[model samples]
Target: MQVVIEKRGASLKVKDGQLIIKHGDQVQALAFNTIDSIVLSKATVLTAEVVAQAVEHQIDLLFVARGGKPFARLWSPYFGSIATIRRHQLLFSRSPEAVAWMKNVLTRKMENQQALLYALAMPNHATDKIIESAVLKIEEDKQRLQQIEGAKLADLSPRLRAVEGQATRRYFQAVNIHLPEMYRFGQRSRRPALDMTNAMLNYAYGMLYGRMESALIKAGLDPMIGFMHREEYNRPVLTYDCIELFRTWADWVVFDLCRQQVIFREFFEVEAGGYWLAHPAKRILIQHLTDFFEDQIEWEGLTRSRYTHMSLFAQRLAALLKEYKTDKNKK
Candidate 1:
């Protein structure tokens, strides 16, 4: 079984170690052990006992704020996962090998970004031109990064920031061109996505982020610690960083759905420069996004669902961190 998400207007209760979900007039119960993550789309009435039980079972509870934004998450520790702490320490140790590993990680991220751009550019020559420009910007950022001294981490940071902004702009431009005018925003801004399509996409993005956060926690990584994204006061910077690697996947899913006409433009509205998805549209988009993630996708010599691939990637990262710590201890 995979992750389980419960929407609003639904109630969940723990009875004899089983989770009973009540939706409308129907009720379904499942063993709590079978559950991985629970998403609360809106207000939920969960008991303190149930919360405690979920924590004991290491089940992640994710809460979505207004406009379907994931603003808070709660997770329990795995019994024997302490390597993430060690990895954090290694990252701060400032050793040559640590720096090398960080560089490798960043290189992989760049490669993934390139792959996504290639996919987006496949549809048209004009789009290809835009993607090529973005690619050049990425390359320039990489070159600048290589020339930066270790003492100038702050200087290298801005290059990465510029590259990310360029990449996102390229992506959004392609996306906006394909989408209805209602979904287009001249600049990236939070809240009130400009139309139904944007609202649905934003909600889907939130869901994906919550799932990635749970995966990170399960792998024992500190969701707040990160390299590409700075450690903000309370933001889960690591989750934000890792999400950058996979957000293109979500974008592609939404884009394809829009192209296929599987979703309707009438399902969304624009108000106050923000987009809103009707409840029905939200339901359909969520299900479509969920299925897309669960569908099998080939990666790294294995055929695994995107969801599984994400989990495995987090685990691999954790293992790499452990190896780094072991080498440090030996030295």
Candidate 2:
């Protein structure tokens, strides 16, 4: 994988054939071909041209925003995958079978979330109970959703929002349990994460979000469309919805590694009311996450690696959407 490691806080630009990285008065050049993901930890200078080049090459660009939140993301237009578009359109068309299939998929997703949360809250039974309660709430929501008949879209909206909020609350609570004491949150905090662990979580989550965005696009699902999440400005709603299923698993892996000291604290620092991972730690986290993706996972009586499973899931979602479109065309 092409890796662009940004070590200093500086401005970044792409001119001619080189990536111009500037920190204060110093500037360094890296060839475009040598970089896969452009990781900005504490880098200061970045230009539109740099982003454009990275997008053109389908390079995964990651930003470590304040709070050590690492965001692995790419612009929507450049990274658009044809397969994802087709699948998304297929799924969006409302149909009986389509809705049923979506329900089943979402149910499976919740099951996975429950399992991951249980694992993450090890030695703490409270987390498992919370997940169990969320499961019940999901059931209630599913029933309410199915019962909607000529129901105003507005009314249905609030119900779905309630269910989503409950589920999210449970998930976030579990996430906080794994965080460092300094970064443990009482409520939602944005931008700069307060401690090293939270910073890593933010950055790691960004990377995962980008990957999920790619997957949704490949599945032909509109990233901005969602079932459990409301449409919001500048947010890929569907990506957030689907990510709920897998985020816990990813978080578990990273937290475990951190707790084991596999990723040392020396690779990070506390600054400006937030934490930042050093260049070396960022590299290690990315490498380890890559490994985590390659590691095998068990689902639905089959054992397959996460990378393989993700690809397969995208294909399956695409196929389901195609079926929906076909039936619609017949009608």
Clashes of each: 7, 22
Candidate lDDT scores, in order, read 0.67, 0.61
- Candidates in order, TM-scores: namely 0.81, 0.64
Candidate 2 per-residue C-alpha lDDT over 74-159 given as tens digits, one digit per residue, 9 for 90 to 100? 54365444564455453453334534544455556555655665566546465556556655665565565556443233235465
Alpha carbon lDDT at 149, candidate 2: 41
Candidate 1, lDDT over the whole model: 0.67
Model 1 C-alpha lDDT per residue in residues 276-326, reported as the tens digit of each score: 665567777777777888899898888999989899988887776666644
lDDT of model 1, residue 257: 68
